[model samples]
Target: MTDIEKKEQYAPYISISRDEWKTLNGALNFSLSDEDISKLNALNEPLNLAEIQEVYFPLSHLLNIHIDFAKKLYEAENGYLNSGRKRSPFIIGIAGSVAAGKSTTARVLQKVLSLWPEKPRVALVTTDGFLYPNKVLEQRSIMNRKGFPESYDTKRLINFLADVKAGKEHLEVPIYSHLEYDIIPNRVQEIHNPDVVIVEGINVLQVNLSEKHQGPQVFVSDFFDYSIYVHANEKNLLEWYISRFKQLQRTAFQNPSSYFHRYATLSEQEAIAIAANIWDLINKPNLIKNILPTRFRANLILEKGSHHFVKGVKLRKV
Candidate 1:
């Protein structure tokens, strides 16, 4: 075990090794094929069937347990109160650093959970859509801090979550285009009362103190029925971030409409330098200042190794 894992092996959580956690799968049949995994993987990240069976199958099983219990609890409460209250969607929040494979995790979980026998309707949403448009960021003079908490329209995000938790139907969420590096105006993704909602973002777990005094502070995580933090060492995170940037330079960045089109012509060394600079200046600072601090607040933590594979799992004790 790493020193960090040793330190975290205390109350409120039970730290389990990867081998041990895989046993918790309890003979659950995994139906996802290799092609499905390839499609679900994020750029430059490798996710295979073994990883899904060993890591995510157990995770999906655990989430199923939680979902079942939550439903029972809601039903019991309604019976006692004699109020016909509809059960709200189970919201799962996933928070991690840039290029930490959070998107893949969310997508895989969404797929696995939706495949259950009951076939729950799973909806996936990223907090990127909650980010203020590029124009707003430039106007606010914080375009450099694009992934930071201040870059998000926190009030709107909170309201959206509130509505989702209230069992509101046919809600429209703003769509963010990574290629264009901005919110697409007049475009929205409609979410209609999903059974499970997976919210992924770098700052989903973040809580800003400045917003507290404004009123009853409702953080983005307030509505999450469960939360996950994808953890990795800074070395691995930096390497993965640069690798993804390089891959995007060859692919998405080459497009004329891409916000990073200028980077498409950069040499190998030039791309590395630029990626490192952006990581150091923007992503790293935000990770340390905002994202990393909220790691322990998560109900579950998936610790990753240098190769982006989950090495261990820390689940919060109920």
Candidate 2:
């Protein structure tokens, strides 16, 4: 290939500094209020509001467009038939490697999107809830590979989305507890037909990847009206994972009931080593073998730099 082609190929992962970020988002009209900025700043670490404006404002705008499109599609399909029935929830899928900040992205998106005038009552559901119960994982001898695609109750997840998409009222979902690392028995979170539902996890876009795999017919992503993947290089992601793990160890691990409490007593060096090992052995391999390959399938991509700030975005070509 020519140099130009090679450059173009490598350009998808390009970085944008905080200065350029402002320029990128300058055309977007959305801005966080002083209260919103204060809440975001009150996070464990400081963040630049200008950087957020550059990154997430455009994202929120795109989501607004996606919501509009979904509404139009719903109307066209039902309005023509003269039906006055309510439509189902608009589903969005968010997929990324562990410690890539997809969870944070989902939460931030939920907060921002819920503020919109047209689409209110947004709900966020995680595929983490669809994970097989810890008992089941232990019984199957696959406890170590908890985030793999096969570890999820894919059928139940699909059915849940299908029910929500069909405008089913009062749909219940099993709640998973991170502290206990198990599904709470006889408990469910009720979904009351919201305007948007975002399903996020490490393998949200992953299917069997082939017909011969004989896994299952319906994948969780098939129900999504839009999908997003947070992108970053493996090296940056490994560093980010280590940092998050250390923070979690200092905080969440202090809880008596946390599944990761055993790691709380480790020295700083020891903790870093353990976190690096987990990333190398589990997360990095999974990203290379499964998650990263699916980046091309996303409807849009949020590419971030080392500081966990989004630098650029790539939308799939029409």
Candidate 3:
């Protein structure tokens, strides 16, 4: 079936009301701890914690259940069929448009999931690492399309995920700098065997698993035990993007070596214009063509309201 058709057929195995979602932790009376609240407060942009509780708590509970089931399945299959081999890390993919707060979501999830005794070593890797170097993109004359899928080194990303999921003892992922908007040379992040690995990006569940691709050929998400798509209205997302851009103009964009340094002193109106132009020209198109189209492929969908609170969650039927 086509991806869209498959999404149309999706039904939730467990339906939760907004209130029920917040109380998923039984008598523990689910509440964000002071540390978590502090961390959320430290975010560059605003986030609604109550909304997160209502939306992500139930999702986390569902993920914990899935993790247990996967572990059981792995033990049964490996013990009986393959004579006992250790299963690799549980993988989760988080995808959303730019400024959709997906990075925050991923970080919060890494923190919350790690709190679970069974999954202590949660690791998060962003697909930014897979982006092609700016010099290469400039040479190819696609610098303006940097965040688009074609600008990423998909094969290398796939291989890295493959090795990590295969339980390779140590794996190194290339590092990319947001300030420079390019791959940092000779810099790598070491990932040991993590209980959970969360991969976040604009196109994690992109539904591009055609047969022609092979040799470490599994899509980045083929390794996912669970997947989430953070959803918000296009208008709100655009505004958030503009706001973030203005903030960056004062911060990272002010550095002489930063790629966007030229815009550091732009007037508020001019900065907004530039941000809007970039969003309209590049980000919006990529979202429409690549990112938003895959929302339904996610195992869970966190739908955010105008106030930026997760209003509900749609869980796919098993």
Best by lDDT: 1
Q: Given candidate 1, what's the lDDT at residue 170?
A: 79
Which of the predicted structures, 2 or 3, would earn the higher TM-score when compared with the native?
3
Q: What ranges in model 1 sit over 4 Å off?
A: 1-10, 211-214
- Among these predicted structures, which one has the highest TM-score? 1
* Per-residue accuracy of model 2 over 1-318 as CA lDDT, tens digit each: 999879867664443454554564426665577777666542333356665666676677777887888889889988789988787788889999987778777877787788676648778888888899999999999888788777889888888888888888778888989888888898888878688888888888886666576645777788888999998888888887788788888988889899999998999999999999888777777888889988878888888777777767777654
Candidate 1 collision pairs: none
How much lDDT does each candidate structure score? 0.93, 0.79, 0.81
Ranking of all candidate structures by their TM-score, best first? 1, 3, 2
- Name the better of 1 and 2 by lDDT: 1
Ranked by TM-score, the better of candidates 1 and 2 is: 1
- In candidate 2, the residue pairs with backbone N, CA or C atoms under 3 Å apart (3 or more residues apart, or in different chains) clash, namely none
TM-score (all chains, Cα) for each model: 0.96, 0.87, 0.89
Displacement of the residue 131 alpha carbon in candidate 3, Å: 0.5
- Look at candidate 3 and tell me the lDDT of residue 58: 58
Least lDDT summed over 10 consecutive residues: which range in candidate 2?
Answer: 38-47
